[model samples]
Target: MISPVIQEEATGCGIASVANIVGKTYPEMKAIANGLGIYADDTALWSDTQYVRTLLKNEGIATSDNEIPFTTWDNLPDTALLAIKHHQEDGKDFWHWVVFKRIDGNAMVIDSAAYLDSNTRTDFGEMTPKWFIKVSLLHESSFDA
Candidate 1:
């Protein structure tokens, strides 16, 4: 099940996304990330896949990080943590973490950084996913192998 939307603070996108997937409050997850030495208080940056994987492990969830091409977007699971890259007006690739899921037959994205106060799903058509973390049960084996 997908968790409630949690707004990101500065570089909290990665932490917030991980929190949403693990059913933790943003502050709580931030604290955990900090204790794990993955959060940078000075810069408010938290973008470490290894740390994210450890967080999932602590929650009893098995996951694997993968770089997925856009052509395989349709193969993504209904609910997932996605990393999307888009070119900003500054002529640079801007990376953002977002939650991807389908609600009522419509694909949508829950981007805390985009709309903070609101917890609504937006159209995924505008997003360009570059990477994703695949979460699954411990006892299950991936079909990819």
Candidate 2:
């Protein structure tokens, strides 16, 4: 039930995360991202939060305005975009993007890296998240319907 969209490119984790959150395929999100001039190859896509936020905004999804520092996995919102595998290169910070979801009171992570044998993950003990952006599935305008 948690089929993650695999990143089609080496630097496409951000795009893939957006796809997973929005229920779109990698190519589908990639096309929209390209149309918005948000390319995966841009280093800012991973090192900065704006790109992912922008993509989500364009799709009518709402995310927290600020990055919340990681505390405990149990404290994460029902859905979130988590930053893991963090490191600095040339004094710039970078991280891998993954989606956290709570379904039927069960939590699992969706990782887009193509190297993973299974993308739906539950080994939370193995990951060290640096921060996260809480994803809201509904836009304020949704209530207008």
Candidate 3:
């Protein structure tokens, strides 16, 4: 699980407001996350291990050149939290925040986002690649071990 402090830093009150709160640059934060074994990539809209490694490299984390399994939404690890963009039918983009709290039951939760209007919340089961960017964060202990 991500530390409360780090989680607060990563997922600020709102996406727009986050820009100001996430003191570190996007690349910098990404690097820090990568150092902690989080996979932050901008690949083919999917979570491939190689793609993740590439993303880590892009964020300045050194890694051995190797191929690895890609992580799918359905296969994400329990210790991971994914920040994805959820596309709406009307063509507008909605930011979706999801924490992989449990993998055994194939369940996840969409916490909240800045783009949501007042009194609205999105769920993990209600996400799609069209509207969301797939970013993952790994637990500190998991990264250390």
Better of 1 and 3 by TM-score: 1
Error (Å) of candidate 1 at residue 72 is 5.0
Q: How many residue pairs clash in each candidate?
A: 0, 0, 7
Model 1 stretches with alpha carbons more than 4 Å out: 1-3, 40-48, 86-94, 103-106, 114-119, 143-145
Best by lDDT: 2
Q: Sort all candidates by lDDT, best to worst.
A: 2, 1, 3
**Candidate 3 ranges with C-alpha deviation above 4 Å:** 1-71, 86-97, 103-106, 114-125, 129-145
What is candidate 3's lDDT per residue for 8-93, written digit by digit as tens?
Answer: 33333222112222334444544554565543232221333343344434444333233223245555444333445544445533
Q: lDDT for each of the candidates?
A: 0.64, 0.92, 0.36
Instruction: Report the C-alpha lDDT of model 1 over 1-99, residue by residue, as the tens digit.
Output: 455646446667767777777778888888887777767343324344566677667666677656454456577776666777643544544466777
Which has the greatest TM-score? 2
Clashing residue pairs for model 2: none
Q: What are the models' TM-scores?
A: 0.73, 0.94, 0.29
If ranked by TM-score, best first, what sequence of candidates would result?
Answer: 2, 1, 3
